[model samples]
Target: MANRLLEVSDLEVAYGDVRALWGVSIHVEAGSVVAIVGANGAGKTTLLRAISGLLPVRRGTIALGGASLAGPAPEAIARMGIAHVPEGRGLFRQMTVLENLELGAFQPKARANMRQALDKAYALFPRLKERAGQKAGSLSGGEQQMLAIARATMSDPKLLILDEPSIGLSPLVVQQMFSLIETLHRQGVTILLVEQNIHQALKIADYAFVLKTGEIAMQGTGAELIADPEIQKAYMGVLEL
Candidate 1:
């Protein structure tokens, strides 16, 4: 597709003798939210890492805006406009919230747009603006997730990759987090999210891919999968009484 923003085709990644992802392919169109979900060890995070250039690609290709994006350094990937907010938030615990955010603008292109980006970040998460002077480590769990996402926005990325945004968050916070994702989608950010919260992820995603044993086992529109009997049983934890 001419407007496809991110594409991963037959992507394979390995660690030592163990292969984490084998021949996985995904296509994300521009201006949409795509979700990847599966049981633990399904290689969802591995795919994001490969696309962001944190891990080397053993095979296949990842393209953003029709250009190869998986061959560069992690910093170079940021410059190419793929922002990955990893599984653990990955903030500098010792640094102030503002400092951690400033670090995300490390790439030359991002640095040049830092001011406007910072403004946009703060606008999205006002709690972050209040905590700008406080250390990232000191923030509450929900606030930390907010900062992680806000920091990524500082890079002015074309694609935002979020891994497990609901991890450690309260039920109320998870709802709020999902709300923010909806807002981001409305604001024109193309998002690729991996989450254990299958119900929530599918609710907002335009498309959903179910990963199993390091490969895409199922693919469909969000509503289609949400209603599928197999998906409902496997991932939804559906209880038939």
Candidate 2:
């Protein structure tokens, strides 16, 4: 528990009258990959939004590096070592790829490391360097996803939170994307990923949680969850005789 880089306990969030998350608790250990998988509208996005301080928490708590993130603004959260790549690959469309990455290091600490971070990102994603001058909106889907992840690294985040990194990609591209995620973990990055690609997510995750209708349905080591008959039946469309 003390080693957890990101912790959310009994987290509840809502959008006006509608509740999106209900008492969801999850934790990511330092330098490990943890994943949350759920169907659409199952409160996965709400949970990430609350953790990143983009949405207000109606109840519960989010803590990073053992400090509470109760009411900090989104930018404050980013400076405190959390980088969120929300769904839809939120990018500055008209900006050049290099420019988009530059914006990620706007924080004082991040700015200090901007050059090093840019170099590091380019190292991890060589294609980004190849297309550094291209407009972000003109990039292909896989390239755009790479830019999103690369830009998040520009902040020098302690906890990198990714939402649906595998959506809308070819199988080969998805494999490549997962390889980058795996590489990030191998090089000492703590990640909390939300993905609909259940098989690949579990395959790469150290731990996995299943969310349904605003609640955590199951939590276990990725292998444990993957082997569970109920999980296989529901998420993987497996049938038991």
Candidate 3:
């Protein structure tokens, strides 16, 4: 059996009294890419936030490497080896590219190997090296996204959770972003991706889940989901009589 890197079972989350997720369960195996694809308000971000410890779980379990992640803070979750690159590509606007990357290594284990991490980060994103001194806010949309992923890797996370990595990018840039994700996977990072780009997400996913109204709607291998007529009509813009 493959090693399960991240497992979430019966996860329920809420904002005040309004529930956002209901009994959601998902697992990502080591060295595999698992995608959660859904429309807006489907609670994709809620699920990611719950796993990252940004939101309190009202029910069920979240385990990383078989250890519980119930009460830890967000930073604690990061130290536990799950790096979340949120939807907005959160980076310090006024800071230089190097500065943002350095911050990613604040964890003890990562801090110890910061230099090597920096080297690897720059190697993966040579543009970041070129703009090492440039303010993060000044970079183009695609370059900023690149820096975001590079920064997340500075922690050398066991599982990388990406929330809409392709959002707001041009079509060409979206392709490049997905290619970069593939590169990261090739380098041995297990991924749990939450995306609205169903076709692209499913194309790269080893396994996938569809979320609707904060609940699981369907699931299958990438190819299987892509070929699914229901999925095609609903998310892929295919017309069926």
If scored against the real structure, what TM-score would every candidate get? 0.96, 0.96, 0.97
lDDT by residue (1-241, candidate 3, tens digit) is 3588888999999899999999999999999999999999999999999999999999999999998898899988898999999999999999999999999998988999999999998888899999999999999999999999999999999999999999999999999999989998899999999999999999999999999999999999999999998999898887332
Over 4 Å off in model 3, which ranges? 239-241
**Ordering by lDDT:** 3, 1, 2
After superposition, the stretches of candidate 2 with alpha carbons farther than 4 Å from their true spots are 239-241
lDDT of each: 0.92, 0.91, 0.93
lDDT of 2 by residue, 1-241 (tens): 7687887899889889998888999988999999999888888888888898889999998999888997899888888999999899999999999999999988887899899999999999999999999999999999999999999998888999999999999999999999999999998989999999888898899998999999999999988888888888888876332
Tens-place lDDT per residue, model 1, 10-106, is: 9999998799998999999899999999999999999899999989999999998888986788877788888899988999999999999999888
Residue 127's lDDT within candidate 2 is: 94
**Candidate No. with top TM-score:** 3
- Model 1, total clashes: 0
